[model samples]
Target: MEDKKKILLVDDEESITRTLKLFLDRRGGFEVRTENRGSQAVRVARDFRPDLIVLDVVMPDSDGGAIAQDLGEDPELQSIPIIFLTAIIKEQEIGGHGKAIGGGVHTYLAKPVEPDVLISHIQERLGV
Candidate 1:
């Protein structure tokens, strides 16, 4: 059998992390790990070594954008794909757009994201 795709989900909300982790693991057929603190993202990413990262934009300790920047600067972690799950931009605001952002690895997905769409994005990115 093929190796299950690994994903690291970083968000400040326990409920959000819990739900997404369960959904992605059970329904999406992927291995999922989560961190509720943005400040710990890089550390956890180094340990988990995820194939992709699902990140939240805003957090109390650290912001997702900053975490992304840190990840990009790290040679071992720079190539990982990051998807921003944010409430800052609504789904309609981007015209249902979910594309990689300017930095060349990060993608954007508005919050309250539907599970199916999220899974589709994950599969598309992983080519699974």
Candidate 2:
């Protein structure tokens, strides 16, 4: 066996993190670490060095799209793929998320997401 794919989940809500953490870690073969604030995501990522990140698009101080840009710009963190999760985004607003942060993330997932769906995306993206 090898090291599990580390994942950092950033959300401002505790329930979402708790719920998703269980699914992503147990079934997805991932070591899931979570942050309940958007502002803390970058710092946590620096320390966690997760293979993949699931970020909440709408947060208290900052949004996931902005966080992704910050990570994408850094040479050390750029290669780590991010999946944006949002509740309010309409179908038409999906593609332009890249433009908001001036760059594109690996994938975007909607909020109230099913456990299996999120797990599937994680497996597919991290190849776990």
Candidate 3:
């Protein structure tokens, strides 16, 4: 069987992380890990080495953009794709295809996103 893709979910809300993890786990094709603290995201990512990251934009400790920048600056983690899962924008703003907010390169998905939609985006990002 083909290996499952590894995914790291970085969100400050434990509930969000847990729910998303459960959804991803049940959906199959992915090996999922969750980190509820934004400050710990980079450390966890370094250790877990996920193929992709679903990150929350707002956090009490660290900002998602800063984390993404850190990951991008790191030679070892630079290649990993990141999808910003945020509530700052409405789903309609995504306009069919996800967009890069603030002119950044990473894709952004509005909050309350459907699990199936998230899964499809993950598959698209991973080329699965």
lDDT of 1: 0.87
Please give, for residues 5-77, the per-residue lDDT of candidate 2 as tens digits.
8999999999989988987777886899999989989999999999989989899899887888899888889
Report the C-alpha displacement of residue 80, candidate 1, in angstroms. 0.5
**Residue pairs whose backbone atoms clash in candidate 1:** none
lDDT of 1 by residue, 18-88 (tens): 99999999999899999998999999999999999999989999998788888888889888988889998
Model 3 error, position 88 (Å): 1.2
* Candidate 3 lDDT by residue in tens digits, 6-45: 9999998999999899989988458999998899998999
Off by over 4 Å in 1: 95-102
**Order of all candidates by TM-score, from best down to worst?**
1, 3, 2
For all predicted structures, in order, the TM-scores are 0.92, 0.88, 0.90
Worst 10 residues of 1 by lDDT: 96-105
Candidate 2: C-alpha RMSD to true structure equals: 2.5
State the C-alpha lDDT per candidate. 0.87, 0.81, 0.86
Candidate 1, residue 5: Cα displacement in angstroms equals 0.6
